[model samples]
Target: MDARDRDGPDRDGREADFTWGQARDFANQLIQAHSGKHLTDLEIKVLQGSWQNHTYEAMAEQYTYGAGYLNRDVGNALWKKLSQALGEKVSKTNFREALRRAWWQQGRSVPSVPPSVPPSVRPSVLPMTPPLPAVPLAETPFAEGPVAPQSPFYVVRSQVEDLGLRSLLKPGALVRVKAPSLMGKTSFLYYLLQGVQLQGYATIYLDLGSIDRDILTDLGKLLRWLCARVSRQLKIPNRLEEFWDSDIFGSNDNCTAYFEEYLLQEVPQPVVLGLDNVDRLFPHGAVVEDFFGLLRSWHERARISTLWQQLRLVLMHSTDVYIPLDYNQSPFNTGVPIELVEFSPDQIQALALLHHCSLDRPALAQLMAAIGGHPYLVRRALYELGTGSQTLGQLLATAATETGIYGAHLRRQWLLLQQNPALWQALIQVVQGTEPVSLSPLTLYKLHSMGLIHRHNNRVMPRCTVYRDYFRSMHRADSP
Candidate 1:
């Protein structure tokens, strides 16, 4: 009979052709063969979840565990283990077929399709640690408040991970990180800096925000500060007098000369210069344009200049570059572009665990729905909950109010909305409904840049539940 021959009695003499036991047995065999090791307790549960084709969320509900981890983290780890074991690429979506192709060699090939779960019984045999019990609000995890930026609590998610261990040998390699305020732009840059250093590269960090306004007012003055900072960090003596030539060389050439002639020679390794808060330059028109243009000139130099090739750049900013820069002249347009986004539910749970919070899976989901995984907000919740400052329920309820934890931050944004009634009314559309509302492109850009909304295709929605609830409350109380 053909493989498709149908309507046969099952092992239990039922009409069904497949059973969970068959799928379980096949999956276990593949795991044992390809994983090079017996499946751990959690790994088996993960395999079962994948075999059943249950959404991580559905499986989490079944097993009472973190959906995010059970979905991707565990899946990724399992696939990685399989890939190593079988010397092949394996992922959750196709691991079964990959195994089937191998199993065919033994002449005991199981069916390619997974067995269907009967409507009646789905066993949740996953053995894992139960969620941490919520602590009292008074025992807040972060009694001192926000962890220092780039603290150990920073949890990296799979989606936002673009700066992997890839070689940066490409000359003039540039990376631009753009996101709205409080989106972890600074934190991401620090991580990149650390990665490069581990790769035996030297890094110089320049926070343009720290440059005095007076220095930025003059091109020569700012370049001098730049040279001084880089040289200082490099431990190279500042040879300012040796390179100064006001009439003979322009500021751009002068700065490049300082790096080429006097500074870089002291260093024997490639330099990764990480620039933070580039938005500070937008307001200073001539200064920003000329300075950015000078930076671009150096990037262009790498094609022919070995000295410049030794230099790499990482730029971080909080908004769209409304500065009207030319393509070749804007550093934002070139190099690998990455945008840090809000954390996913799984990443949030991982971070919560790092903070020593025992928040359950449902609580984690509810938290994400409320705050949308705003890096700062999610961390704040975990920190507070750990310190026993507020229960998860309490945090959600008081989130949008004037006296709430985010009161000051919400008030500042509310003021901006009040100043622009059009933006206020546009937000009203999003707040009043579950579906996203359409807005003009520039309008959407401006609103999203302010971290006020998130765009879905041509429509706009509040960035998170916190934003919607807070704004709604503010409209009733403050009318902003």
Candidate 2:
């Protein structure tokens, strides 16, 4: 009844007996009351062990069970029971906290204090936040933003202006840019367009990804569409209308010639073409050949009183595209190839600072450990840190979980390993080797590119602890 009465000792000189059974009963009652489930003896014992802050391996050892068996049987079983009791599934990582809260409500002491914040949670200190606004999928005439230097389009502008792409803008001059998805390919094109616009050049942004393969088969329709896009971007009044009204619309070769000879060549300003996902057109070889041929012919034959300074062509693709430029060679091999690498740790720090997060060296190292400076993943993790209410440690832990982008990337690598058993074997061998694993060039390149493994001392190694643990957990069968 009184505060001290329940916990006070009897005349016998011993303190109050806190038997394991009493703990189990208390846990059971809490589960039944709060979670609407009855705990069996084993489940109660498992809960009691977890309440004591016992590791899974220790629990398994104490119960004379295998680690996997304990996890699957006791751990998962407790989760299901708690979910049924709480009306929502509880993750295993949070189970101890939930159980401790239940005990505290009953005036019981927690068995142990949880660890302090994990090491990965660090602050960001970077500048230059991403400037591009997320465009809605349904929007038309996508709203334009500032096309200034130091904008998100800075890289593209730098590329175009610094590289003198404007001078090389000709029908025959094909430009190739290589980067992974969401690495600012579109933004770069917009930057290039700005240069073209400033130089009194007509430009066409042809989104090949949005085009149908069937449309490419009809060379006449493709030419007409290209002309219309050019007209729209250049604000050429009645240009598309005049073309549709002409007899060239019915003839593939004639329409191609019309666009080459009149639309592109006769424009008052020089014309630049921006074709996104140009690789998608490779399937239609004939159409692609004819289109490039027309462009070449226009470059060679077009004659006006004042020759346009440049005919700029910006072609973007994810993978290499081999387009024949000359009779003896392909067009893809001729142009300058720019490969986009992942952001450096310093760049990530810059981004973190832009978001007003603390990206100190430790934090940067931790983040790079988890994501390897992949731009999108680093941006996402930083965004979570910036926007989330959780403590830095909690955010980092969340980032490590499979739900976050870092986890998703790790999962992708795991799945790839599963698909190729040899690769997985090689990975495990490398990780477990006393010395760094010397991998074949092909395997090393693949792993490095995927951001799963890194090179150290000329050997392949896991990128982070999460990946190392993943391999270790799965290596149970093969591990001694």
Candidate 3:
């Protein structure tokens, strides 16, 4: 018998002689061939662990280190080798795909293809061909699992570049990006910062999500933190100490005055300040108003300053917190409000390509339709598809249930609706009525701001079918 038959039959009864070392060597050879860099012993070990589909936590446990440490070390080591080989930096997450491709190259059995699309729902467009190269595994920087490539995490091209979002970084422009959780808000901000830096603008990314209402009570400290963060990011010399020693944080007015006079005016390059999760600052209106007013004041001063327009601000937030300023007057409202909508068909296709999935047009369309373009939902559905076991109908039904990413988000919203019956009533009226019921202006505004309903043709409408059905079910169950 051949060596393959001598070893044993795989679960499928096919002759196989696959061993752990064989898998490692196969992965190494593939990396060498594609990446042109030799893997270190540590990297090979990590790759072997990864090839076995071990979690970072598990790897850490095996190595007696923290998961984060193992992840970072392995990630950095992989990135170093990939950069040396490819002559460009490859992100940590994409490395997983490289390993998968290596397995395929080694004559190992490939995962089964997903079932064919139903004839009734075939796509109008032809299938995308393989001429488009697969995104090298080492280049993707997100985590690996059976996630759909169409998910937001997969759609992130790299840390420093995303052509779709580059325009938001123009000097002195205001931009607002909104999405629900796991839609890649933080990742997008990182990309935007990288983009702005490439354009010779300085960037400071602040996560206001961690700040509380009490922080707003001390506006001086807030401004000081902002100034120091900007200074450090820009490599401005001793910026925090300079501001502190100069008494910038002594009082609210002192901080604002110093920001307008020194940091804003004296900065060497155009500044792009990204305030992520700005909704946390909203509960303290005084702080929010003051902080934004400082930005507006500096923006006006920018036109007259000897330096180029000095500063721009981008605010990222979820739908929970509302910004009460009028669009025309507010700095965030003045420039452009770009709602990072759900993934487009092309983006989803890009994801499939990245994951090396053989998704045809009809299959792609069916996936998008079921998820309603929500990013996390799309990812979860694509993940299910990647497994090549579940049916499209099963994936679609799960997309609506509470088990997948989309379902979890829906459950959160459903629970919120249950807590606030007025909100529930408002949603029901908007969904079931042919004409928009005239809700109290405050209620209408609040719901719209919360993303529960959207205005269309002077009428409020429910945001999604899931929400509509939720209220409909409640309404029916209550009927007696």
Question: TM-scores of the models, in the given order?
Answer: 0.69, 0.52, 0.60
Candidate 2: where is the Cα deviation over 4 Å? 1-161, 164-173, 216-220, 237-256, 282-309, 320-331, 389-392, 398-401, 406-480
Per-residue lDDT of candidate 2, residues 254-336 (tens digit): 55545655565656656677888875666576777776666555444434423423455667764322211222323345455
Q: Which 10-residue window of candidate 1 scores lowest in summed lDDT?
A: 124-133
Which residue segments of model 3 deviate by more than 4 Å?
A: 1-125, 128-171, 179-182, 237-252, 260-267, 323-332, 356-358, 418-420, 430-464, 470-480
Instruction: List, residue by residue over 1-480, the lDDT tens digit for candidate 3.
Output: 444433323534322334444444444444555664435444655665664567778887885668886678665767666555444455544544443343443333333222375655544453322112455545443332323322223343321223323444444666677665556677667756655664567778888777654665667778877666666766655345444544334444555555666776767777787888876665566677787776666556655764435677777777544424332322245555665666667567655655555566677766754555656556555555555546666666655555644565676666666666776777777868766566767667767655566677666766655555555665776779
Best-fitting candidate, measured by lDDT? Answer: 1
* Candidate 3 worst ten-residue window by lDDT: 143-152
- Model 3 has an lDDT value of 0.57
Model 1, residue 432: displacement in angstroms? Answer: 3.0
**1 versus 3: better lDDT goes to:** 1
Q: Model 1: runs farther than 4 Å from truth?
A: 1-151, 164-169, 320-332, 478-480
Give per-residue lDDT, candidate 2, residue 29: 49
Please give the lDDT score at residue 204 for candidate 1: 88
Per-candidate local distance difference test: 0.67, 0.55, 0.57
The sequence of per-residue lDDT tens digits that candidate 1 reaches over residues 27-117 is 4444544543344445656766665555778878886779887867777887887676546898766665554444333323222223475
Worst 10 residues of 2 by lDDT: 126-135
